[model samples]
Target chain A: MAQIEIRDLGIDYRKPKSNEVFSAVDSVDLSVEKGEFVTIVGSSGCGKSTLLMAVAGLVDLTRGSIEIDGKRVDGPGPDRAVVFQEASLLPWRSVRGNVKFGLEMQRWSGGDLNERAMQMIRLVGLGRFSDYHPHQLSGGMRQRVNIARALAVDPEVLLMDEPFGALDAQTREIMGTELLRIWERAKKTALFVTHDIDEAIFLADKIVVMGRNPGHIKEVIKVDLPRPRNESILDSDAFHELRKRLRAHLAEDMSSMQLVQEVA
Target chain B: MIAEFFYRRQALVLGTLSMIGIVVFWQIAVDTGFINPFFISTPSQVAAEFKVQFEDGSVATNVAATLYCFVWSLGLAALVGTILGMLAGWFADVESALEPFIWFKYSAPTVAFYPLFVAGLGYGTPTIIAIAFLFALTPIYANTLSGIKNTDRDLARAARSFGARPLDIFLRVALPGSVPVMMAGLRLGVGRALTGVVVAELFGANAGLGYAITYYGQLMQTTKMMVSIVIVIALGVLLTQILSFLETRTDSWRVDSGR
Candidate 1:
């Protein structure tokens, strides 16, 4: 059985400037098996984050429903945890404190809370910096804490909206590799959103290409490359071929709106 | 030492120079009888009188009465105003419902209403405390309501996502988030209450620093009157500094995102 099933999900929000109804996310349907890692890749303002918010139940659904393991997504619950792009950590808390905060909310008690939090801190390669506050952490280290905080809850569905989006290219690549290593051990269902096609290809079993200007899905290409993926995989024929196909698809999609071609 | 001196030197030097100059001028004036020693008491005369008052235990009763009024007004107003403000901030309808009463209490000349206080509560410690409470409440109410209202909704939503119930959101997120703002209110409140106590005591009370000023001034003991005024001002400054120090220490966990 599918661990999460999202059917014809739609989200509408107020445009901040004026009195106009707009769709941030339009009719979309997707499903994730219990352990499959899916990545949604899109341009900026493509409503990929909004889609993640819908899955997390932070935003209201205008149409359709999402079921997490046969239970409908009502208001936000502990079962689904989200990692925001900006590492929305509680600044007052230390690394361990932030990680343990979820467990605290879940009514965890005794040394188990500390033990569980420490383990996750170690998992994120932040064990040495356990006592450091979020303000003391670098962008990469903070994102690591963000990921660890999400995983600490032992959530079934991990929703990440470009968690490493703001890091430098080098740091982002390192984090991508680190994420795969952690995901393999945890084996949690993930729905990650990123603008980087390479990041999507490297992290996801299924790369969902999204197009903005009404926010619609462009393609959903399944990456056939097997697990424990490495940098050498980027040079492989299959990886190059898949990247070529997606690029062609994006280029063709952009051809109709060729005014952007000059800039691209 | 040089860098530190340069960093603070101008203000420090000016302050020290002013202090030295005032003392020098005061000593010379008293020696030359330039200013009447009885009316404009030099700092030395006041200090000597303070020592006399201290030895005789006269300062204690006045100090105690002033402190009692301070504690009464501060404690009662803070508790009532803060709770009411929290409630009003939490629920919009409550804010609107109580707006008139809160506004009236805030804007109406509390000092002019001194007669009403004396009429109802009588000219005693309670009346003085009541006046202080009235002056102190407006800031506490306004700041508290704003503090709770201004708590980041994003954090509240984030807490809610983590299975935080309404109580948890209020206690952990809203209340802690409101601490800095609430502390600002408390600082303003203490200052206002001190002023109120002085006013009420002057008009209604037979003892306390305000009474000391009045009792001495009526007998043309200007030096004693100035001494009482100085004591009240010093008390205000001391209390403000202590509360502000506590605020900085306790709310250090918070980020002032300027939100």
Candidate 2:
């Protein structure tokens, strides 16, 4: 049985200024095995983040259902944790306090909550900054704190929505590498969303590509890359081949979107 | 050696010197008959009056009366304003219902309602406190409403994703996020409440700094009246300074770098 099962899921949002309700995601089906790392990649408005949010139970599903361990997902639960794009650390809290927030919410009484939060902070390589507030840290450091906060609760599944999207290219790459290391040690099922192709390929056991205009999954490619992948793989031939295939898939969607624009 | 010390503490030194210079100039002017002491009074005469008032305990009695009204009115205003503001911010219906009335009370001359309060509560401490409460309530309510309404959406969303219940989200995310602005509201309320107390005392109160000012003025005791005036100004500065210190303490997170 899959650890996470999302079948024929759909989501719709009403326009802010208009009464029209439009589908943000539709008929999306995916299965994530235990401890598997899956990445979802698409352009902005492709509903990739929406799909991730549905799995995290933050968004209400309009059609079908999402199940974890064969149980239906209705709302946010302690079994899952999410890392938002903006880091979203509370400005009033220090790194350790922000990390402890999830545990505090869950009413976690399993031994010492402070110790658990401190462990996660150190895991994210921010031990020295445990007492630093959000504003005292750089953008990349803030996102690391966000990741630490999510992981502190010891959730079964980790969901990320462009966790490093706001970071510079160099910092983003470093974070990706650090995330994989953490994922290996933590050994939890992770579903990451990103627009960076190399990021998606480097970190996933499978890559799900989505298209916009009533979003649907276009393809799911199984990555043949070996474990403990490094930056050097990005320069390899096989990595380039996979990148080319993914680029073609995205380019087709872009041109189709342009054609739709022209028609309108 | 002294240059660096003076440069570092320039504002304190300059402010103190400027104040002393003004008092000295005023004393010289009064002594030389350039300004009539009967009308304006000399700095030394005012100081002598302050000593007499302090020794005889009149200053203590009047200050206590004014402070009694100020504290009660400000406390009730803060409590009532915060509760109503939170309700209005959370519920659209509550906001819509309260909007017009709040604006009316905020913009209208609150002093105009003093006669009605005096008639209802009967011209004493109760009436004085009521008038001051009404004056201080609006800014606190307004700031809290805007603060809650403008809480960072991203923080709330993050808390929701962490499985925080609605109550948890409100208390932990929304309330804490709104505190800086709420403190600002409290600061404004302090100033307004002080003004309200003085104004109310001017009209109806029998024992307060404001009443003393009026009494001494009618008796043509300029030096005694100046004592009350100086106390009122000092109280305003002291209260606002304390609130500003607290505001900055709560604001440590928003400020970058310099702890």
Candidate 3:
């Protein structure tokens, strides 16, 4: 059975002033088997993050259902953990404290909790700076701690929404490499969302391309590139061909979206 | 060595020198008959009165009474104001309910209502404490409301996504997140609370530093009146310093944010 199953899920939020309901995610059906790495790529308003939020049980489903490990999700649960784009570590908490946050929320106790948190911190290569607060660290280091916090829960599904969106290009690539290395060991079912096509291709086993106006999946392309993927893959003919394909799909959607906008 | 000390501590040196200069100038003016000693007490005369009041222990008693009223009223106001403000900030209905009264309390002359408090509480320490509490509550309530309202939505959402219950999110995130601004509110409340205690004591009570000031002034004992006024001023400076120290320590995380 798939670790996560979303069957025809929809999310509608009411506009505060207009009192009109707008659909953010419409009829989105996807499933992730255990230990699979999936990425959703789209434009700004494509509802990709909203879809991820629904899967994490942080948003109300307007239609259908989300099942995690064969159980319908009611609200946020210990089985799923989310990593945010801004690396929202509590400013007052040190690196170790931030990593321990999810475990603490899950009512984890004993010395093993500390052991698990420290191990994740070390996995992310933040061992030397465990005692430092979020504000003291660089942006990339903070995102590493953010990843560590999500991973510490030993969740069945790890949902991430542009987790490295704020980092510089160079730092983003380094963190991406580190993330893949970390995933090699922990191998939890991962669903990542980003607009950067290179990032989606590099990190994902299968990339789900989404389109905006009412937000639904457009295509699901399998990334057949071999792993362990490194910077060398960027120069390969196969990698270039795949990147070209993804770009064409996205550009076609963008032009068609602009045409619809002009008519409306 | 003296120059080095003076250079390193310019503010302390300048403040001490200015105070000494004023005292010397005032004493010279009175002794030379430029000002009447009976009407305007010299520094030495005020010092003598302070010594006499200290010897008789009236000064200590008055200080204790004022300190008691200030501490109790401010402490209670801090607790009540923060809880109410957190609720108002967290829930829209609570905020709406409090909006009108908060505006009224903030804008009205709270000291003018001291008579009503004295009428109900029967003119004693309780009345003074009540007056201080009423005066101090507005700033704390306003700041705490804003603090909680302005807490990072991302952090709260992140906590929620981690299976944190509402109560845990409040206790662990909202409360700590709002603390720096709440401390700022408490600092503002300290000044208003001092005013409250003085107004109530002067009008209704026979004890406290405020009463002592009025008592000495009515008797035309200019030196003792000056002493009491000095004590109040000293107390204000001391309390403000203590609160500032505490605020800095509590918000040590803000050092990196440069807030």
> Best by TM-score, which number?
2
Candidate 3 TM-score to native: 0.92
Q: What does candidate 2's lDDT look like per residue over B75-123, in tens digits? A: 9999999999998877778999999988789678988888898778898
On TM-score, who's better, 1 or 2? 2
Q: Highest lDDT, which number?
A: 2
lDDT of 1 by residue, B163-184 (tens): 7788887887778778877888
Better of 2 and 3 by lDDT: 2
How accurate locally, in lDDT, is each candidate?
Answer: 0.84, 0.91, 0.89
lDDT of 2 by residue, A16-132 (tens): 999799999999898999999999999878999999889888889999899998889998888899999764888999999999998988899887988999999999999999999
Q: Mind giving the per-residue lDDT tens digits that candidate 1 earns over A1-264?
A: 798888988788888889788988787888788899999987776788888888888889988899999999977877888887654777777899888877777676546888999999999999899998887789999899989988998899899988888999999989999999999999999999988878888888998888766677888888889889877787889888888877776675566455665478
Clashing pairs in 1: none
TM-scores, all models, native as reference: 0.89, 0.94, 0.92
Ranking, lDDT, top scorer first: 2, 3, 1
Which regions in candidate 1 have their CA more than 4 angstroms from the true location? A14-19, A109-111, A230-264, B1-39, B255-259
- DockQ (CA atoms), all models: 0.39, 0.69, 0.61
Off by over 4 Å in 2: A258-264, B1-25, B28-34, B256-259
